[model samples]
Target: MLKNVSNQQIINVFKFLEAAWSTTQIRSISYEEKQKKQRTHAQKMIDMFDLPTKKKKFETRKPFDYSGDFGELEPLKDDETMFVYRGLEDKFKEFPQNYSKVTSLEYADGQEKMAHRIWTMQEKFLNICKYGERSEMIIAQKTIQIRNLKEHCQKNKKDTLARVILLEQIQGRKKELKKLRKRDYKRFIWLLKELDLLYRPHPLYVDLNTRRARMRQYLREETCRIIREKINAVYTRLDSEKENFYTEKEKVLSEIRKDLSDHNISAYDVLQNVRKLRQERVVERQNKAPPTPNTYRWIQSDKDRKKAERRERDLHRNALVKKGMQKLAQSEEAS
Candidate 1:
């Protein structure tokens, strides 16, 4: 029996079994089980849709008080004071010199350092006189916190809680920054420049999670790639054939020149004369003196000049409208 068995025979048997299985009626479930399954699925969908979309409440961390005068503290002068305020001064100078005047930053713990950093960022973004709780200032503070948390998470690796906090801070900062941008674009730009941040806005229409969206993106990318490749191929072909094209063009030109001479159109070549004229015009333009700056030169016929300018403006507007219409038509056709 084993000797008689072949691979094709085995495959045929499997295929027949598969076909039989496909034709066989499915096992019917009880009404209660069916209802229960449907209910569970419906509840899952309902829960998904009912989930709250409210924005997360971000904690507003107070800016560290950097007002306490550390110089007022009477300590031993010179070398001894340097030892007492060694690491603290350099680390928390931005925080309050008082925190350092008391003890070193490493001994005072990371909280002081974090406060100092936030204060530094706030001082940079906010007004010097009054460090108000402006959106830009808050965003700047969050940005520093995010950076510090990110660094800590990277070093620790197992600190998942820190990572979560970092992500929350990032999202909060992003939302605030976006709001700030909408409220005041100039302030937003200034804040970003001050904080050394690059704002990458989210897409308006595309959701990359869906299969359809992903396929559309892939199709667009492939279309662009194909177009670029085809253009390059066409250019390469043209370059290869240009020598022959130029030779033929020269022959046709010579024949045309001969015919023109025979017809007594002109004694000298008209094209040659045109080329000389173009070169002379270019040379004249190059040699022309530039107009003086900060001085208005009065032109003759100012009324005519104003009329001509208005006419040119109208012509330009009409041309732009025509171009825009053509583009709209092209887009409609493509869609």
Candidate 2:
């Protein structure tokens, strides 16, 4: 039954059991550590007499069933082969046993007692073997499927290693995308907006036309929104702490006042200064030499202007002809 089970499966089982046992022990130790106080006499005595502590005798090593030099065997392609071999070698090196010796007993009905004991021993051994075989069968089946999958991946254009690397990268990107979407989405949008504005003429450098005025309005709204958010965060932090609430509020107000003063503006008269700044920027822009004209653009503008003049002349000529025709008809009717 054990022949069907791969070395890797056995090693994996042992490793899992070891890890789980270690974790249990760690949790138990942590709980005890949190107590801080010393253990009671009864608890200490119980720990001393625990089955794990009492069982100390090393088990005898079993001889390997196969009698071949492992070194002579070809190296396995799978990365887990060496790990499995080491794990199995370590496990078989020393096995613990609970009892050192077995006790014999005598009975009045000797033949019947001996027969019953033999039957019971055979039954126990069979049952143990049956369970072991069942476990081995399950592990062997799983190992076969895993080997098939590995073989399939190896045969395909995209091997397991490449697939694993790709999957890892995709997972990492997904996490980054999730963070961007959740926390930095607004900032990301704002950055895109700024990039778009970079390609266009700046409102301060251009005449305050309808479009420039609208852009300036948008910028002002964004600035106000940022300031309001900052003020709200400060308020929230202050509100959370009950001590010196009034004092904190006053300090926040003083900071705001100082910021406004630095900008040469007052809180109540902010709009006036903002408008003045806009006018000053527009004047500065107007004072600068105009941009050099593009030759092609200038030619296109001249053509458009001539077309408009021609259309106006045609309309005027048509109106004069209509008036002359109307006056002739009235003169004919009067004659």
Q: For each candidate, give its TM-score against the true structure.
A: 0.37, 0.15
- For residues 1-335, what per-residue lDDT tens digits would candidate 2 score against the true structure? 99999999999999999999888784445767656444565356446543122435897743221111111112223222122133354454354421111111221233333333334434444554454433223322222233333334446755757446544533443344344445656643453242221112124665555634655666678789999999999999878775687778999989988998898886767778888999999999999998997879978999999999999999999999999999999999999
Q: How many clashing residue pairs appear in each of the predictions shown?
A: 0, 0
lDDT tens readout by residue for model 1, 80-131: 2233344555566577756555564344446766665566556665554245
Over 4 Å off in model 1, which ranges? 1-133, 144-167, 180-198, 205-245, 259-335
lDDT, each prediction:
0.70, 0.51
Candidate 2, position 60, lDDT: 75
